[model samples]
Target: MNVIPYNYSPEAIRLGILHIGVGNFHRAHQQFYINRLLEDSDQQHWGVCGVCLLPSDKNVVENLRSQNLEYTLTVCGRHGGDEVYQIGSLRELIWGVEQPEMVIQKIAEDTIKIITLTITEGGYNINKETNEFDFEDEKIKHDLHYKDQPITVFGFLAAGLRKRRAGNCSGITILSCDNLQHNGDTAKKAFISFIQAQDKDLAEWAEAHVTFPNSMVDRITPATTAENIAKLNELSGANDKAPVHCEDFCQWVIEDHFIGGRPALERVGVAFTADVTTYENMKLSLLNASHTLLSYPAFLKGYRKVDEAMRDDDICRYIRDFMDIDISPYVPPPAGIDLEKYKQTLLERFANRSISDQVSRLCADGISKFPVYIVPNLAKMIKDRKDLTRLAFLIAAYRHYLKYQLDEQGQAYDILEPAKSVEDEQLIESDSAADFLNLSAFKSLNLKTAETFVPVYLNFVNAIKDKGISETLKLLTA
Candidate 1:
């Protein structure tokens, strides 16, 4: 028997954007939008030059190269329905850790107008206290010492911008697709702090010339599994080397701020607006908050899959109540979005049985994720004097998961725990449930707000212990 892999010829397009942290979401949302521009218009100069931040990304790089940097995306559904989309928008691929100079050189090029990042929430090594670059972080220190090596993303950006300035290249957009509040602003602050710490004049020049666009991106993309690989081959009839499978929903809303150049993304399903805060708040507060709620409880209940837990009536009802009660009031919807309808659509999407998004996947990086996704709503609910029973339950779930204990049945599982530093990458796991809340982490929280949360959080801990996980679920849901 003979087998042939699909071949996609690279178009003669100049790289106008360099995307760092090119993960599944980047492929599904950003690259998908670029693909639309490629097919509809003649301006092919905006093709993406992909940059993988981590050394482990070599697997994806090799797979992409095998298929000439092209892959398929399937927006799968609960039933037997699915939508297939494909595009060759990644014209070039560069592994940052392997070829650090290439990343800097490409970014310094006059043709590259944008440098987008999907480096995840925790990837940016910022000091939580100062909200600035963590100079003490080994990676940051190494990057600063070996400034020529361009080891870290911030280092690469700073070095490239300095080069562009020396050469008088046009200013480029720095877009962040991470789930941080005011993500673009955070990226800008990090860049500014790092640059200023090193050189004052360059920092001022970057401040005056560059553009940082904040965006809200949504899609439920689980880690690639054997099943996912098999599904890609079965559904698409091509052995996709780096296939990205997701639920049948996707959304990208951006502030229409760009420097030098941009793709006609509006031709696709992207929304470009003046104020993306409302959209950002809605997605983070409701969608992400609810996800944080379900993640731990589902894992504690021994349901590994997101779609499976969504099928549980107990879980589904709690999810709905979480959105309508705890999360909805805090989230001001973007223009033209019906909050209720949107919630309904999200519930449907979450319940899509075919997509096996994992609970552990959602639970990762809670130290960073909760601060943005859950903390704001928690703070707002306290301000409004709303009942925190639902929010408290989420905290309780975190506490229970931190125990990292199997149920009475002796099944084993894992939950993410924070470390003392980035170098101490191991999770600080323990059987003590209270250790999970880490009240010290919330000490900087407003005095009045923090005091109120203490009692409710304590009450939740009692409920989780006095009653079992299922009973706590019933109490919260009822």
Candidate 2:
């Protein structure tokens, strides 16, 4: 297989976008698009400066720096051969954990027109109930006192914006390229709230200058395993340390309210819309929510690979019914979208063996995920007095997975719940089936008060424990 390297000069490209999280999703999606855009001489200044905020980012950052920030991206399709590309859009790198001052300075630089983020859903430090910044956070408190030497992303944003104010630099856009629904607005609420608590003047400056545009991004990017790296190096014939692989499909719909201008992204298949509400709701409710719906039960049933999970007739049927019967009514089709076809395409994408998205990736961070992906639609369903057996079963399975730490086959597995607090552990571990409903993920729905929802949920919870997950799912799907 021939590896198609970027056509343009890498050194000539300068940084215009300071992307906060240099993760696989960013590499596979946004950076891939920018790499394409950089092929044109006029877009040379639009290259990305990847910022690493966490200590976990050290290895990837070191690898990219070794290669002068150039890496490979393998695009796997549902039914076609892989297209290998040596992407060069990531022109610079900065690890904020090591150099917090530099992170602030770069954001203050007028040359950097936009600050894009791939910080996962829970990274916002939002109080789930209030949907605002959690000021009581110790790190946030530290940032408030020591604004100049910042640590958190919000701290970096505030300090940087303040520096920009002092330097009289033009305002920049803060676009969230994450999976969170209404992500831009959420970001605005968090940043503004934090900045307001720390400095009134800086908060006002950001309020006037900053624009957070809502965006809907799609791509099935799996975590690159050691086997993937070995195979990628074999196929591309490159000793690339920071190589990334994702499904061929990618979509980024922006609210088109960019400050200090934006790249000609539309020319590169990016959609610019006055409103991203419909797209956000549709994608969140259908793809993201369905991913959550299937993850626990599928994992509990001992399926790790999404493709393998989808191969099961009952699993596929469950997901299909979820999209059509549970979610379709609320998700109005965005322009040019055939809802039914999109749902079919999603199934096909999930079933793509080449990509093989991990069921565990879907299973990770369910504490944060449930609130974002599942609860909204679940709340609506409860309000409408609709059939919620599937949703209830998902909760039951999640409880079983978390509390037991064992699959239906009695195989012990590690669960990844990044947002799991001590209190969350207590609730999940509580013997009472009804106590799990009070988990922060479902707090907004107030499931205890949900007359139609609780009885069914508790039934599944009790039945799954008594009869086992396999038998219970067989009954649910029947």
Candidate 3:
């Protein structure tokens, strides 16, 4: 297949956007949009300068740099087709760990007007219970003490914004594409808190100039496996590294609150609105929460791929009921959105055979995900006195998955929860469901003292323990 590459010359494009955590999602979603915008118009200056903060990102950074920061993006469709595009929007790649000063300088540069982020939900270092930046985090502490040589994202932001202020560069918008609720506001709070602690003057400057616009970004971008790479190479006949693939469906709803001018993203499928809360809530609750609800149970049952799990009748019904019965009630319909269609579309997206989203990817960072995606809906269901059987079973599955490292097939896998603490370990290991319910993580919701919910949840936990996942799920649904 002769793939048409980016039409614009690399020399003419200017780095207008600086993105942190340049992983698979950023490439497939945000960069995909920018690539379209560039192809359609003369807005060549809106090119992205990608930044990788962690040391582990060296491989990707090197790969992109060696390839002149150009890579292929294969968008897979549900039925079986795919559209391949050469993404040239990524004009530059910077490894922050290798050259922290360069990262700061790029941020301070006047041409850079917007900074976007897809740092995972836990990267903010917020204490879920308190909903505040955790200054006590060891990385935060190090960043606080050694501001010149920073490590965490917060440190980089604080230092970078300080440089921007000193240089008298125009204000920039920090748009967060993470899946958290009110992600833009969360980013503001986390960044402002860090800056305020480091330098009151810089924080005040940021308050006056910096803008964090909340955005709801949706796209199912699976981790690029070795098999995917080999297949992509064979199809394209190109020895490209760091290529990315995602589902063809993509949506980006952003608040139009940029300090400086923004790319005419609206020209190319981006929705710029005054308020994104409703959209954010709907997506997070229905799609994200449903993912969490299905992940642990599917993984524990030895299902590795989301589509495979969706094919299972029992698992499919459980997720459908969980979304319609448990989550849909809490999510208000965003403007111009049909809730019924959206729910059905979510199911279709989950069942997209071409994407092959991994259960392990969904199960990763359960500690952070549970608080953001599951807790709020769980609390609402308890308060409303609705059916808690499915919700309870999901929690039970999470606990079981956490406690036991082995899946149903007796295969050992490491649970990738970095936020698990000593207390969390105790709660996961505890035999009593009531003990897990009383955890400080869920203390804010006070589900522990619920008159009916507690007992129902406990019973579900016991049933799962006594009668295995399959039978318990059948009994719950029946």
lDDT of all predictions, in order shown?
0.78, 0.91, 0.87
Pick by TM-score: 1 or 3, better one = 3
- Write down the worst ten-residue block by lDDT for model 2: 127-136
Sort order, lDDT high to low: 2, 3, 1
Cα-based TM-score, every candidate: 0.92, 0.99, 0.97
lDDT of 3 by residue, 268-344 (tens): 89999999999999988989989998998889788999999999889999988888888887888987899999999
Per-residue lDDT over 1-478 for candidate 2, one digit per residue giving the tens place of the 0 to 100 score: 8889889987799899999999999999999899999988998999898899899999999999999988999899799798899898888899998888889899999999999999999999998877767888899999999988788898899989999999999989999988898999998998899999999988888888999999999999999988889988898898999889999889999999988999999889999999999999999999999899889988988899999999988888888989999999999999899999999999999999888889999999999999999999898999899999899999988998899998888789998998888888999989887888999888888898889988898999889889987788778888
Per-residue lDDT for 236 in model 3?
71
Cα lDDT, model 1, residue 106: 88
Which prediction has the highest lDDT against the true structure? 2
Which sections of candidate 2 miss by over 4 Å? none
Reference-based lDDT, residue 366, model 2: 95
lDDT of 1 at 434: 38
Ranking of models by TM-score: 2, 3, 1
Query: What's the true lDDT of residue 311 in model 1?
Result: 84
Q: List RMSD in Å for every model shown.
A: 3.2, 1.0, 1.3
